[model samples]
Target: MSWTLTEEHLADLARGAALLGTGGGGDPHVGQLLVRQAIREHGPVLVLDPTEVADDALVIPTAQMGAPTVVFEKLPAGTEPVAALRALEYHLDRTADATMPIECGGINSMIPLLVGALTGLPVVDADGMGRAFPELQMETFSVYGVPGSPMAIAGEGGETVVIDTRADNARMEWLARGVTVRLGGVAHIAEYAMSGADVRRTAIPRTLSLALSVGRAIREARQANTDPVARLAEVLADTLYGHLRVLFRGKVVDVERRTEAGFARGRARVAAMGGATGQLELVFQNEHLVALVDGEVRCVVPDLVCVLDAEQAEPITTESLRYGQRVTVVGISTPELMRSPQALATFGPAAFGLPYAFRPVEELVPA
Candidate 1:
């Protein structure tokens, strides 16, 4: 079925996208603003389902690759994706049947939508990862054996890089990241060539619908004067391995940031509230990578850790976590699809150079 996205849907899309980001997608606010602005300047975005594309259709997933922090600081030249896609298309000797998102998180969620609206292509309703992760290779496309390069990266400065390297996904990530860093730490990227059949097999199906449900639940709960968090928890109960835990409710006490290997690595400490009057610390790389309660590891990657404003219930991206802001900590288990042995080996703490063993969030969180 075809759908036209309107201004009324942007908020829901953002909220839903945040929930799906699973604590790793960059802040969705920037992308939402970009989409809103584009809609005002252009018009509503046209969305199409995977089935709408021809079996032989060349589908491309488009997104921004960089430090989320840098994205906010270095605004786009407003033509990166279009420029990159056009260039990549010219090189491929073909045009895209439809454009889709690599993942649904922060800016990535809305980027393809905006690109589609401007370029007059239908934005596919599916995505590679239902939630976001730090590296490009973490996508389902990679897991399903799709190539990452022969890809395109476009800078706001009109610099474009198209590498047709036959490198593995991990190597491709290293190469692409190096190029992005040289381009001033961020660039728009479009990659993952796949037929409609491959897309349907690997991509997360009905993700937009899931996002819409999540967003609608929060909105309806607020209108009914119910706890939005609780509403969200209920909606996601089945997929979550454990009950939602309100880890902490407090004001940000401190923030420390450093860049490592082109990633924004940092820690945020929050002064606790109510009965738990103390502190909680969160360590992050691009997205909230880990959570510690009073110096004890509470949740780690391969599990979802997120921070949200106590009042707004909006997600607080790792890049945006700061001092003096009141926020609540939330932890949910990663979906089974993402917690497989192979998946864990790739994203687990050991993968990040940490000493912790991989454990299910259900075993980690207190019952």
Candidate 2:
């Protein structure tokens, strides 16, 4: 069966996308607004099921690669993803059969929907990384041995780059990041060449549904005057690594950012609330990478770390974490699908320059 995006689905989609983002997918607000705008202007989006795609179909996943901060400021040229997909098609010597989201969190989820509308291709309901991550190679594609390079990157000016290299995923990350920075800190990317069968096997199926469910739960709870965050926690409680922790609730007191090798490396501190009155420091690079309570590491990468407002429970991206803003830090774990050795190597603390050995979030948190 197929699914179509409608005006009614926007709120739930945003809520669910935020939850699935596990606190890293960037903010879903702009994407949700853009999608809602598109629906209002052009009507609902046509979503095709994976089964509807031909077995040998050439499916390409598309996403925005860069600082989520830039996205909110510059606003896409509106033609970047279409241009990226066309560039990939030109290089591949075949038109794409369908386009899927690289992931369902934040802007990446809505990007493919816009691309599908612009290109007249059906948007597949599946996604690569069921959540979001900091780099291009963090998807299931890498876990399944798919090459992230030889991929296409495009800018609003119609300029495009086809990255083909013998280097592994990390090196590809280094090169792609440079290109992204050169393109003014963000560009559209389309990668992961796979047949429908490979996609069904490697991609997380029904992620849009998961996103919708999570979103709907938040909206329903809010309408009922219930605790939205608690309700969201309940929806994901079973699938997540362990009980979610309300790591810290406070107001941002400081922010420090520096550009290192094309990544926005920085840390922000928030003053805690109520019984826990202190500062919580969060280290980040595009995505939140670590959380520390009073200078001690409480949670680090490969475990989900996100910041939300204390009252509303909406996400606040790393770039948006500001001084004097009240927020709550939420910690969840990467799903088992991403806990494999290879997965950990790609995104664990080691990958983010932290020296500590990796441990399951369950072991690190208090019982």
Clashing pairs in 1: 28-106
Quote each prediction's TM-score.
Answer: 0.91, 0.90
CA shift of 25, model 1, Å: 3.4
**Residues 1-367 of candidate 1: C-alpha lDDT, one tens digit per residue:** 8788877898998887876665446667777887888888888888888777777888888898887777667888778988888878987889988889998766788888778768778888888766777887787777776787779889998988887776487887888899999998888988987888888877876566667777788788888988888888887776433356677789998999876666777788999766667788887777776778877777787677778788867777777777888988887776566676777776778777766776765676765
- Residue-level lDDT for 118 in candidate 2: 62
Off by over 4 Å in 1: 22-24, 51-53, 238-243, 275-278
TM-score leader: 1
Estimate the lDDT of model 2.
0.76
Please give the range of 10 consecutive residues that has the lowest summed lDDT in model 1: 238-247
Output the number of the lDDT-best candidate.
1
- Off-target runs (Cα >4 Å) in candidate 2 are 22-26, 40-42, 48-54, 238-243, 259-261
Writing each residue's lDDT as its tens digit, candidate 2 over 245-307 gives: 777888888999765654556888888766777888888787777788887777777777778
Give candidate 1's whole-model lDDT. 0.78
